[model samples]
Target: MAYRSQIRGEFIRRYSECKAAYLETSWRMIHERDVKHRALNTEFGYPEPDGSFGIGCKSSVDQEYKRRYDEIESRFRKPYDDQLPALHRWALENSMSVYECLLMDDIWDDDLKALAKLSTMEEDWQFQPIIAKARFMVARWKEEHVVGEIQRRVKIESSHFHYAAARCRNLLGLKPWDLAAQKAIFDYGKEWKSALEFAFGSLTAA
Candidate 1:
C-alpha cells in the first residue's frame, strides 16, 4: 500500500480523470446526435421549429430521436458508471473512511488542521479528538443534506449541536458529549475556534 495521502491524491486524480472522460464522451455523442437530427430533418422534410408538419411524419421523427438518444446513453454513459465502482473499491481497500472518500474536498482546510491538532494533543486525551470529529461530521451532514424544514430547525436549535454530536459520537462507539469535551474542542486553540465557527453559524456557542 502507498502513503495514505498519496492514495487519497491518486483516487481524486483518477476520479476526476474518469469524470472528464465521461463528459467529453457525452458531449461528443450529443453533437453527433444533433448533426444526425439535422440531416434527418433535411432528408425527411420534417418541419423546422417554426414550420408545420403532418402528424404521421412528426411521429416517425420522434421515434427516430428516441432510438438515437437511447443508443447514445448506452454507448457513452454506461461504461463510465461501471468504472465508478472500482474507484470506490480502491478507496475502501486503502482504509479510507467513507467520509474521507466522499467529503474530503468539502471539508474546510481549517477544520482539517483542527482535527490534526486534536489527534496530537495530549491534554484531555480521550475527548479532544472524539467530540471534535463527531461534531464536524454533524456539521458536514447539515451542510450536505439539510433540505427540509425539520432538518433546518434541527440544525439551528440551541441544543441540537450537543444532541447531534452525542449521536455521532455514539455511532463511532465513543462516549457521550459533556462540558469538558465541548471545551476541549472549542476552547483549546484558534484552529478549533475557527472550526467551531464553521460547524455552528458563528463562534458564539455550540
Candidate 2:
C-alpha cells in the first residue's frame, strides 16, 4: 500500500488534535451552559426559566437544550457532509446495529448524500487506496458523529468502532510494518471514540 507522507502526517496531526480536544472536554463544558441558563433567568411558573431550578421541573431548560441541539446539529452537518462513507459502512457492517442507522438519519437529505457519495467518488477514493482512505474516513466521521451525539441521542442511534480501526491503524497503513508512528502516539486519545461508542452501544444492547 502506498501512502503519501504529507497526507499521513496531516492525519496524524489531526488525530492527535482531536484526541486532545476530547480530553479537554471537562464536565464543566458539558453542563455549564445548562447551568447558566438557570442562573441568568428570573421567571415565575412551575419549572419556568426564572421559575424553577429543579432538574425535573425545568421545561425552559428542556426547550433550551432543544434549541442548542438544533444549532449543534446544523453545525455538525458540515463535517458530516465531508466524512467518508466507506468507513461508516465498514464499521456498520462489522459492529453497528440497525438502530444506529436509523438514529443517524441525516437531519436532511444532504446529510444522507454525505453518507452515500463515497460510492461514486474518484477512483482512488472508491477503490485503489481504500484502506488508507478508510483510515481517513473513520477518523473523520468519528469526529462528526461524536460531536453530534454530544448534543443529543434519540431512541435510535448507531454504534461506532472506528477507534478500533484507529487502533488497528498499523495494520490499515501503507506498509506491512512501517505503519505511521503516530498510531501509537494517538492510541489513548482514540478511546474518546468510546463516548460515541457507548452512545450507540446501548442501542444494540437493548
Candidate 3:
C-alpha cells in the first residue's frame, strides 16, 4: 500500500521543479538589475539630490533611473513572461490532485501556493484542514506501525527462543559432555540472542 510519506515525496519533487524555475527567473532579474543599476549610478556621476551617496540615497536622477531599470527588467522578464502560459499549463496538467495534496506537509505551503496558483487550485485558507488532517494521520500511522512491529518481533523472538531451548534440552536426554553437542545447543542460544537484540534495536534512537 502507498504511504502518505511516499505520496508527499512525489509532490515535493514536482513542487521543487516549479520552484527552481521561479527562483532562476527571479535571480536573473535581480542580478541584471544590480549590474545595470551600478552602471546607471556611474553614468550619472552617482548623483545625490539629498546630498547622500551610500545605500538608500535618493537622487535627482530618479526618473531616468526608473526608466533605465524598467528597460533592463522588461528585457530580462519577457522570456519568462512568455513561458508562463506554458509553465502554468504544465503545472495544471501534472500537478497533484487536491486529495494527494492533502497528504503534504504545511512546511511546503509557500511552494505549494505558487504551484497551486499556476494550476488554479484553492489556497491554504480554503483547505487548511487537509494539511492538519494529513499531518495527524501520518503521525498516528507511524506510531502505530513502529510500535506494532517492535512488539511483534519481540513476541516472535521470545517464543522461538523458548521453544528452541526446550527442544534442544529434551533431545539431549542429559547434559552433553562432548564438545559437538555443546556447540550444537549453544548455537541456538547465540542465534536467538541476536534475534532479541534486533527486535529491540529496531526502535529509533534518540
Candidate 4:
C-alpha cells in the first residue's frame, strides 16, 4: 500500500508539472501571437490615413486628411488588444483545449499536422513556422480567388469585338483592310462578344 501511495503521489506531481508547463506555454503563445499581429499591422501601415498601408486614395498634402488618417490609424493599430483577452476567456468558458480552439478557429491545416502532433508531446514547441506557412497559404488563396476573380471581371467588361479583331489582325500581320483580317475579325468579334457576355452574366450571378 505504501508503494502504491508513492507511485500515485509521483503521478500527481508529474501531472501538476505538466499542467503548469502547458499553461505557461499557452500564455507565451498568446503573447507571441499579439506581437506578430502588431508587427504585421506596423509593416502594412495599417490604419493609415488613406487605408491600411496607405492603400486609401487620400492626398498627403491635405492637412485635414492627414489628421483624420492619423487618428484612425491610432485607433485601429491595436485592434486585437481587447479581442485577445476575450478569446482566452471564451476558450476557458468552453473548456476547450488549445489545439481544439486552434482547429475550431481554422488556424491549423494539413501542412501543420506534423507540428500539431509534436505540440501534443512538447508544450514548449514553437509553431511559428507553421503559423507563417498558414499566412502564406491565406495570401495565395486571396490572390488566386479574390484577385483573380476581379481581374477576370475587368477583362470581360473592358473587352470589345473590335479589340478582338484588332488583336487577330496584328497576330496575322495583316492590314486593317485585308479580306482575311476582316473575315477573321467579323467571325471572332461575334463569337468573342457572345462568349464574353455569357461569361460576364455567369460571373455576376456567381
Q: What is the TM-score of each candidate against the true structure?
A: 0.36, 0.23, 0.37, 0.23
TM-score ranking from best to worst? Answer: 3, 1, 4, 2
Ranked candidates (lDDT, high to low): 3, 1, 4, 2
List of clashing residue pairs for candidate 4: 45-53, 47-73, 49-69, 50-56
Tens digits of per-residue lDDT for model 2 on 84-116? Answer: 343444434444322222222222333333333
List pairs with backbone clashes in candidate 2.
43-50, 100-157, 100-158
**What are the per-residue Cα lDDT tens digits for candidate 4 across 47-100?**
565554423424467566556556555554564344445444444554442222
Ten-residue region with minimum lDDT total, candidate 1 = 1-10
> lDDT of each prediction vs. the true structure?
0.45, 0.37, 0.48, 0.43
Error of 3 at 92 (Å): 1.0
Model 3, stretches more than 4 Å misplaced? 1-8, 47-66, 77-88, 100-206
How close to the true structure is residue 119 of candidate 3, measured as C-alpha lDDT?
36
Instruction: Highest lDDT: give the candidate number.
Output: 3
Q: 39-125, model 1: which lDDT tens digit per residue?
A: 555656677577743222243347765565455445645655555456445545655432233223333544555555554454333
Model 1: residues with Cα > 4 Å off, grouped in runs: 1-7, 51-57, 61-96, 104-206
In terms of TM-score, which candidate is stronger, 3 or 4? 3
Runs of candidate 2 with Cα error greater than 4 angstroms are 1-3, 9-14, 41-206
